[model samples]
Target: MSEREMETTDDDRGMDQLHVAGVTLTGVARGGVETCLMAKELGVMFDIGMCPPGAQRYGTVLASHAHADHLGGVHYLASLRSMFGQKPLKLHVPVEAAEPLQRIFAAWSELEGYQVPVEIFGHAPGATVTIRRDVQATCFRTVHRVPSLAWVVERVSRRLKPEFQGREGAELKRLRQAGVEITDEHRAPELCVTGDTQIEFLLSDESAMARRARVLVHEVTSWEAGDAGAIARTRRWGHTHIDELIAAAERFEGEALVLVHRSMRHSRKAAEAVVARMPPSLREKVHLLGN
Candidate 1:
């Protein structure tokens, strides 16, 4: 079945929902307009575009950059959570953007006559943070006009050590009682959300997790592959073109390659047509997210 056939919409909230690779992604992504996505199963939200409905539920938000379309909703989310008696929101953003965002939140607090409750952490490329006991997030640098990051969430599990693989249950229990470490921790990349970045991000050496993630949410702002000038213009603005993404698609070993942050100039129908014309190998894994 096609990705579109498995997709569903939430018109009341003005969000598009997609269930792929065993996770549900909910939110909107329109270039220069708004771009927020929630991976509820991971208890995290990527970006906070205008703080759409149901965003308050996620205790943690991983922001890719400071663009208005991606990070504009930071204050709104914090305030909403406070109003509803929820814990202070935990927001993780690029190190370069952290202080500036804090200043912005201070300004908002002064204007509102109340402090906005939030804990913002600045993370540089290669930084990792624990989202939950089994889930963690790691950020990597992306090529963009401003400092930006692509977040990868990994699920960690423990498996029996190779040496103990064939051991009987009683022997394993005895080893455990004797304080022997019988398992090794393994981390698997589950989802990767690249906020807004040039195509160079995918080609970079630091993009291993983005390529290996089970689900990759990438931006393709320019859908017109036929226009070389248009593709050039998109790169100048630090965004990806469909042609660039298609060229690099095979490098991604993920189950779902979700294309998002499409420019308003192209309609959904037009974008779907572009996907249809792609090589079958790339087409099957590519899915569009947004109305």
Candidate 2:
């Protein structure tokens, strides 16, 4: 897997762009401000940070939590799609935030004099949602101040079994005609997006799929280890520190470990300097998302 920075033109709506692991990630993530990311190839948007431009193009949204910065734009997304005559939006959020969000939509419906055309599905940890016949998303709990979850998008395909790999097309067709199963199903975890989480999420047992995904987008809000108590303070806020991530970097077996949700207190250059000082092996796989 290779990583390359993509130029963001006016059409990108101020979102940062990066291409890695066979997919392009476009969006912005800033601590306490807004965070939204879209994997166009997967047709899914993670979080709706103020519903930045071009967000309505995706029909499905997998929200990680109820934080305003992450989910504030949900209503706007639904409204924009409705205004343009697009299909109703499908939103999957944590079970705890589902009811309150529905109520918010109800109030919006009352104020607008029309029902909001958004379908909200509540999912608990370990729930899976089918995005398409060949694609699906699995949800898992993450440590955050709110009820947060991470999403792992996987693609399923069938390949010829080992015994049939050398068989000719005609023979494979014959085997199929004879009711023999000549192929085996393969599920590959393509992407994992953790909206906002503490370091514990990476250390938890539930992170198996996330750790193995081709692209892992995790949050790192605190970039500097100011003092002995700095790390603890960041954890108290339910955010991950760069130091914590560096220590556990080896646990991640992904092709790309993209760090995001940077706080305004730290400049991009400062973060880059920190990343540069990381161990070579881990630094090679680490990337900072957003401009």
Candidate 3:
């Protein structure tokens, strides 16, 4: 763990680096610097804080909000994808950021003397965006200084109807012939990525998707025992403090809980010490993504 921590570079470029429950999570997230996560298998990225050229391989990017620390590299990413002759990048963003982002792209096109191939889709809270045939991203509002969203990636599956569980194949065929629906669609939360939000977002019922996700990647920006005033600063800035995270450990039922976007003020050693102090079970389930 120590060696790996030391190896984390400014951009956190890697392939299939951190596998959690069949999904690969990799990114660079130091508070106020950058925050991005690429789920390689799903071909979906959560943010583009500092989009590395390699990220072009992912066909879609879901921007949580317009915060520069999270979506700063979007234009550069689009330009790179276009330059490499990759297919147009599909960007899913909050509805509020659509116009400004489009204007920025247009300006870039004018400045660079070429149009960047990019498709932008603005989604409102509680809206669902399809990522693929079996998978989709459900956007939910989160507490942030800007209009932000947390994405829950769910996979659609099918299960036999309760009444048809014991039916023989011939009987099932007969039922199908009669136009009976023998199977029910099931949606399971596979991964939840919270770009940057206050602790209340995770503690409230609104975050049910994150609580039930197989893997949760969340932001825990400030984790220091400075003073009462400093703790308030965390909340005021739309971030989560360390104490809040420790107190809310029991609320997370996910198989893995990844903590990212730690404050640059805290030393790596100090942050690890704080995580080491978590309850044994929670500690085992938690993985800190730090720089």
Candidate 4:
């Protein structure tokens, strides 16, 4: 989060690091999970309908896919921003999704009388972009029913190397002119939002966004069915059972993992029982929500 990127409504209580992950279970007019990572450099809202009462805390909204739960809060933000005399917000999305999302925005704009800017960008998988360089964003495709994307955002840095810490001669001049190949690793992000995905795309090495990152926001729409047939059916929609979701988490290392979009059938106890059985390492990072 940068000072220039965000216009603080709370001058008395402004926060620099804006990171929050939430999933709306009900009462938001849509059924889905909405995950957002907020900061001054960039404020992105994943999914739509899952807005909590004060979701406008996120300045800009980014839609990971077109599902209502994921996208439900867009109209609310548009209306509020207009009332407050804010500029149109940019919503980054996949190229293929631009059309349908535009239609949704148009409908909302006409009804609300506020024209919000919808900036749909064609994401290059495994490539990088300067969404305010301090917060670089990369998008990778996920195995959802539709063409969904998962994003990884991390702070970027460049520092003078120990070997050339204070070189002020020709060497420093040359390095600056030639753009030294400084390997400033994009610091591992605090959040990784996987829209709605099946393990098929997640397990791919090409999908680096899925393989490594911190704080995974994945969809666990279904829990273990007492019957194998039901679990098999859940697999068809790219949904993972609690156990299988943990198994997938074990494949990558991260600080925390939040799972949302549990089926209406499963009780919270059922979701917890499944987590109670997970291996110790995976269990520590896993959080089951909206079960």
Model 4 alpha-carbon drift over 4 Å, by segment: 1-43, 111-114, 122-129, 165-186
lDDT of 2 by residue, 73-168 (tens): 999989877876677889999999999999999999999999989999999999999988888999999999999999999998999999999889
Worst 10 residues of 1 by lDDT: 1-10
Across residues 52-99, which tens digit of lDDT does each residue of candidate 1 receive?
Answer: 866767778899999999988889888877876677889999999989
Judging by lDDT, tell me the better candidate of 2 and 3: 2
RMSD of each: 5.3, 4.5, 5.7, 5.2
For each candidate, give its TM-score against the true structure: 0.94, 0.94, 0.90, 0.76
Local error of candidate 2 at 253, Å?
A: 0.5
Instruction: Answer with 3 or 4, whichever has the higher TM-score.
Output: 3
> CA lDDT, every prediction?
0.90, 0.89, 0.83, 0.60
lDDT of 1 at 216: 96
Task: Judging by lDDT, tell me the better candidate of 3 and 4.
Answer: 3
- Error at 188, model 1, angstroms: 0.4
Backbone clash total, candidate 2? 0
Which sections of candidate 2 miss by over 4 Å?
1-13
Candidate 2 worst ten-residue window by lDDT: 1-10
lDDT of 2 at 165: 93
Global fold similarity of model 3 (TM-score): 0.90
TM-score of 4: 0.76
Evaluated at residue 130, the lDDT of candidate 1 is 94
